[model samples]
Target: MSCVFLALKIGKVNWQPKLNKAAHHTSDYCSTEVILRRGQPFNISLNLKTTTQSWDNFTFIASTGPSPAESQQTKAIFSLSEEGASGWSATQEPSEPRCLSFTILSPADAVIGRYKLQLQVLAGNKSSSKVLGQFVLLFNPWCPGMF
Candidate 1:
């Protein structure tokens, strides 16, 4: 007898809504990439190869533009416990063991472009960072408060 199992890496991320809900008619032309709208919330699930400790602090980083800088408002850094009001925010959702799920939201005034996402895990004095992936954020004209 032979046994085989598929393994997922620690930093591997799986995003939902690969196809736009309302844009189903254009699915054929739409690129198979993560495309999001500003001011709207999206879901992402990350698979961890190892179990996380209670003391582990997780931080998410989202940046856009050629030069992404915090001072320039092109970068956003948020944590798992709290959500930001002026920029990007990530809220943890219930999930199974060895998996982390989050509901992420971007400010309406965020820059429209391809944004790179990274995750930083801090466990006491040891810290590690990984580039999760990138997504395209477009202007949310239909969102309330947006002109």
Candidate 2:
């Protein structure tokens, strides 16, 4: 199941939001925020002000809990590849120019709570990060092995 989440555009913004409730099993949510399940994959799209270069590096950070410390398992740092040290991962999906899409997956044992998502971009020697948004992650009741 893959749900769509649109983050901020770098410069002037153009919002075109589309949330797939059926894919994320979030049809029952009453709030405006995104709701996801552990051990599942979701989709996110971003529109950048400038075209991305081959040297550009993107990293995602998802943090939950009050302290949100990495050692406490309340935070996860992942990238465009699934081989990250963090259990969470994001893979690039085919997208249009200056527009990027990703399929993100959280670990099955991730802490269940509200999470703040941030995107960090490393371009050459300079690095900047932006807070994309927040979302709620719940235990996967549908997963047969997720007891």
Q: What range of 10 consecutive residues in model 2 has the weakest lDDT sum?
A: 1-10
Error of 1 at 15 (Å): 0.8
Please report, in order, the local distance difference test score of every candidate based on alpha carbons: 0.74, 0.73
The regions of model 1 sitting more than 4 angstroms off are 1-11, 18-29, 82-86
Candidate 1 lDDT over 1-147, as tens digits, reads 011011224656887665343432323445867888888777888887877544336788999998899898899898875665556788888899888788888888888899999987765566667788888888777767887
Candidate 2 lDDT by residue in tens digits, 1-147: 011112324653221224445666778878777888888777777777767554337888999988989999899887788544347898877888887777788888999999998888765566677887888888888755667
lDDT of 1 at 106: 87
TM-score of each: 0.81, 0.81
Q: How many residue pairs clash in each candidate at the backbone level?
A: 0, 0
Could you tell me how far off, in angstroms, the CA of residue 108 lies in candidate 1 after the best superposition?
A: 0.8
